[model samples]
Target: MFNVSDGVPAGGEPVAVTFAAVFVALFVAHQVGDHWIQTQHQASHKGDAGWSGRWACVKHVLTYCATAMVSLAGLAAVTGWCPDGVPAVVGMAVSGVSHFVIDRRWPLRWLADRLGKCPDWLERGGGLYALDQSAHIGFLFIAALVMAS
Candidate 1:
């Protein structure tokens, strides 16, 4: 949960600006983590049906979170902005859990199916990745808002 606060913190960045920056940081980190940082093995296998797939997803998520942490810290250092501890932790947990759930892959497919998206479309093309990344971005918005608070 986010606590209400003045738009500007000690660093003097308004909440709107901070939220935008935090969202950008999270989004960029997400792209890098999911694309560049993720191992080919993880990408290929994380969605498989087994403990192995679970392990790969877990490993990928760990690195993804690390990249996000580094990105946020770097942003803070460069901008002199700081997030509160509780909200920051809550936000990260939210983001991390959401990422893990989404990367498990089946959840998104199931969701897409339930929502009436074509199953073959998800299987054959960029549909799954699009849904996956969009979910991540949606959660990132929540994370950024909480952190900015």
Candidate 2:
């Protein structure tokens, strides 16, 4: 939805600026949704195998995805940089599913257990936490690209 004439590539696509703007907007939304909207209960109990934990995690992911989708849509409306129709939906689905899988904490625990050792800095989950956030950001980038596609 960006200005079609400005910085049109040889392929006649929108300028890179539009992509960058969408990426930044989505990233900000991700930070707010993951950190602010997520409840402590969902954070604490999501890894459990029980139904309550599963539901908590599901609820968290739903809100998180909604936040990202809304932010992306708003950005599109503001900047006139909307991508193809399916990309936004595909991006959100991928982002949300990946977020859910990573936040479940099973992979982190598996890595920790298999590593068989941890330095002091890595002891209190700094390592896993960083990895988790990194993965989320990576997914967000992909989602942004999909949305800008």
Candidate 3:
């Protein structure tokens, strides 16, 4: 979907600018929300084997979504690119669901196995963390595209 109207990326469209801005804004917010805003309890318990774990993950996702929304608001405040309506809703929905699924931890592990990533590397090395961050950024790009559209 990386279409260009001119010879350059995004073709200098307002929507393209919005997409780039939204992606960067959300990336910054994701870092802040996951690392700084997420609580120790949530981080420790989110992957546990019970409702408590699910609840912890839910709380984390809630706060994460809130952080993202605030970041979008801040973007609007500075650049006047107000994103609303169905596109924004759907974009955030995609983000929230993706975040929740990934934070559960098992889904990623399962996917890694299915993709034939070395289990030892996934567990012992930084591969899983790198995969997790990359996945989040990939989904964020989709969300930003939706919002810009």
Candidate of highest TM-score: 1
| Candidates ranked by TM-score | 1, 3, 2
**Steric collisions counted per model:** 0, 3, 0
Clashing pairs in 3: none
For model 2, name the residue pairs that clash: 1-80, 1-82, 2-80
Model 2, 11-102: lDDT tens digits are 35455665677678878888989899999998898888878878888999999988887887787677555566677678788788888888
Judged by whole-model lDDT over C-alpha atoms, candidate 1 comes out at: 0.87
Candidate 2, which ten residues in sequence have the lowest lDDT sum? 1-10
Taking the tens digit of each residue's C-alpha lDDT, what string does model 1 give over 53-75? 99999999999999999999988
- Choose the strongest candidate by lDDT: 1
Each model's TM-score?
Answer: 0.91, 0.81, 0.89
Off by over 4 Å in 1: 1-8
**Arranged by lDDT, best first:** 1, 3, 2
Clashing pairs in 1: none
Runs off by more than 4 Å, candidate 3 = 1-13
Error at 63, model 2, angstroms = 0.5
